[model samples]
Target: MAHKFPRISFFQRWSILFKCIFHYGMIFWYG
Candidate 1:
């Protein structure tokens, strides 16, 4: 259980970064 926690947190951080980058890319492309 302890080992699983860091993996989940890492995925969450990666997903957040991906989303933020994608969001800004879209705005920069279309805005």
Candidate 2:
């Protein structure tokens, strides 16, 4: 239970970061 917490948090943060990057990239490319 203790070890699983960090892994889940890391994945969540990574997903959020990736989404933001992708969004900006698309905006920059289209605009």
Candidate 3:
């Protein structure tokens, strides 16, 4: 299935995961 997508798709998913982690970190710090 991974072979179906291009490298950019993988990078996009990685970026989204990073953003999600960052968002949770912000909430933990400021909540």
Candidate 4:
């Protein structure tokens, strides 16, 4: 359980990071 927590948080952070990068790229390209 404890070990899984780190993996889950890592994935969550990665997903948020990807989302931010994707949004920033879109705005830079289209806005």
Candidate 5:
């Protein structure tokens, strides 16, 4: 699949980065 807009791709990457940061923060806090 291909994205139609570069902005959408950038947003997708940003969201993935945020998710990873959130996951690590949770693990650090509880583990």
Candidate 6:
């Protein structure tokens, strides 16, 4: 599943990292 994406741009990579952080933060705060 993790290998399907093309890491061709810095913004895409940054956004993915940001999303992972945001999701973890939300779960930590709400769970």
TM-score of each: 0.81, 0.82, 0.72, 0.79, 0.80, 0.70
Clashes of each: 0, 0, 0, 0, 0, 0
lDDT of 2 by residue, 1-31 (tens): 7566998988989999999999999999998
The TM-score ranking, best first, is 2, 1, 5, 4, 3, 6
Worst 10 residues of 6 by lDDT: 1-10
Q: Candidate 3, after superposition: displacement of residue 6 in Å?
A: 2.1
What's the C-alpha lDDT at position 3 in model 2? 69
Q: Each prediction's Cα lDDT score? A: 0.94, 0.93, 0.94, 0.94, 0.92, 0.85
Candidate 3 lDDT, 1-31, residue by residue in tens: 7688779798999999999999999999999
- Per-residue lDDT over 1-31 for candidate 4, one digit per residue giving the tens place of the 0 to 100 score: 7676998989989999999999999999999
Flag regions of model 1 displaced more than 4 Å.
Answer: 1-4
Structure candidate 6, residue pairs in collision: none
Give the number of the best model, judged by TM-score: 2
Question: Model 6 lDDT vs. the true structure?
Answer: 0.85
Q: Which lDDT value does model 4 have at 25?
A: 100
Candidate 6 lDDT tens digits, 1-30: 455655656668899999999999999999
Clash count in backbone of candidate 5: 0
Cα lDDT of model 1 by residue, 1-31, tens digit: 7576998988989999999999999999999
Q: For model 2, where is the 10-residue window of minimal lDDT?
A: 1-10
The ten-residue window of minimal lDDT in model 5 covers 1-10
- Among all windows of 10 consecutive residues in model 1, the one with the lowest summed lDDT is 1-10
